[model samples]
Target chain A: MAKMTLEELRKLREEKQEALEKRSIEGKDCRIIIGMGTCGIAAGAKETLSTFLSVLDEEKIKHVAITQTGCMGLCYVEPTVEVILPDMPPVIYGKVDADVARKIVKEHILGKRLVTDHMFDRPAADIIKQDGGR
Target chain B: MHIAITDYVLEVVQNAFEANSTETRVVLQETAEAFAVTVTDNGKGMSEEVMKRVLDPFSTEEGKHPHRKVGLGLSFLNQATELAGGELTLRSEVGVGTTVRFTFDPASIDTPPLGDVVSTFMTLLAHPKAGSLVIERKTETDGYALDRKELIGVLGDLEMSGNLHLLKEYIASQEAALS
Candidate 1:
């Protein structure tokens, strides 16, 4: 791969700006989630995020935004994943291997039905406090 | 330690390879004050702009390959080194190569606890043909070097799965002596 110049990087960012901006969940009925935490990366969360992006691209799914955040405090069950749907309860899933991630895309994301077993059923209030009010 | 040094080394080296490196050299030295590691690679180096943003925990460069998203590995390395009361310096020249240096204070509160070095070595040795990973551990008394190719020649055609168990045990003992 060739080294990317500042101008080239800026151009690329610009090219993707529309898609990225369109996917933000601020006022749209979109889903947003991030994998934050140290253990997540060690467990291949980077790869998981890439897989999500690829799947979303292939499926041509708009109105969904996927981004990364800092560690969510769970280490053991790394490669952790979270899912949020507009007007729906947010779901946190742990120990998310690639297979489960695909399922999340095929079922929870596209089918609009949560995968019962993998969902973290903690109270939203507790999760909010744990996330420092985010 | 929160993030094992050996694992950190492996992850960084892999990142070097992903940057399209042809040759990679790693040096680990323990001085009276700290343990230092330097990884140099002959890969497509980063530009000043990229370097400026590279250290940010959130910066990522989209690549043709979906998995080529940036910052995850490098950011982790940066955080781990800092948590260890260590410092990480990255220097790269476009079309040239890149070098990363890490210095860790052995007696700092944030210094990560060392773990099983052998497991670290075993995982690295498993990827012999990918690139060269040279690990040199220098102590006041003496030091040792583990070259991936040498390990492969010794194991010869043995299945990676079958050999992993035995190799893990052997490396553990060697790391014990080094520690």
Candidate 2:
């Protein structure tokens, strides 16, 4: 049996309302996706995602939807992250740790500049070929 | 809600969070005879009637989940512990808070594994709503605790996940040293 008091319900409602307001704002077209599959988890992807969340919160950065996904078949670079900005190509970055994640948010997302060093360089055709080959 | 492993301790932790408690504390202990866990939260506690039905897998207050009929967290935990020759206890005061304690016979064949505790703590600590979490694990010889407040003071609010790799290593070393 599970039970919640009226007060608890009210608290939950407030939390949900705050979350909705945080998410449903206008002009929030930037999306950050962190790979959290088994390989990614083993490689510390969760920590990378956490770094992004804290940094965004500390900076009061809004309108960015943060989420997690499964493996991208790039096991060599386990902690992969994809950033999609409105009207820009989706950028995938590999080997993203806490420090690198901060740079992604600061330089790429906010500064409107890509961090070229950590960018995933494999061509789409090559990735497709590898997948099809598998 | 759908846990692949039967360790049910994670659900207890989640419930403490759902209680909208201002503070939450978790303690895990392992001894020669049994393994024990207790979660305490400074949230709105349940009524006597409600607490009595807490294990009634189907018993839940109205307006919790509009889509689901049963509230199974506590109920399932009760069943799991009992099957493992264990006991689950809850103590609460309406305006104060709630505390749940569960113990399992370590030697029992039906006992469930503790599961991936580092992941559990990481997930819980990552939630923005989780104001503060105190997790302490102990065996006979030694124990270590991670307090969010102390961590923030030391690490400058780097985010739980940001520091999780180091945290995992610290926990592993502490456990290893617990001989």
Return the lDDT, model 1, position B63.
Answer: 71
lDDT, candidate 1, B77-163, per-residue tens: 788778778899999998888999888889887776555566666666676444666666678776667665555554433233434
Best by lDDT: 2
- Candidate 2 Cα errors over 4 Å, as ranges: A1-134, B1-6, B158-161
True lDDT of residue A32, candidate 1: 43
What are the TM-scores, per candidate, against the unseen true structure? 0.51, 0.59
- C-alpha positional error of residue B55 in candidate 1 after TM-score superposition, expressed in Å: 0.6
Every candidate's lDDT: 0.69, 0.74
Best by TM-score: 2
Q: Provide fnat values for all models in the order shown.
A: 0.00, 0.00
Query: Which regions of candidate 1 deviate over 4 angstroms?
Result: A1-134, B64-70
- Give the per-residue Cα lDDT of candidate 1 at A56: 80
For model 2 chain B, where is the 10-residue window of minimal lDDT?
Answer: B154-163
The TM-score measured for candidate 2 stands at 0.59
lDDT of 1 by residue, A50-134 (tens): 7777778788877676767777766666777778765456777877777888889898888888887777644358547544233
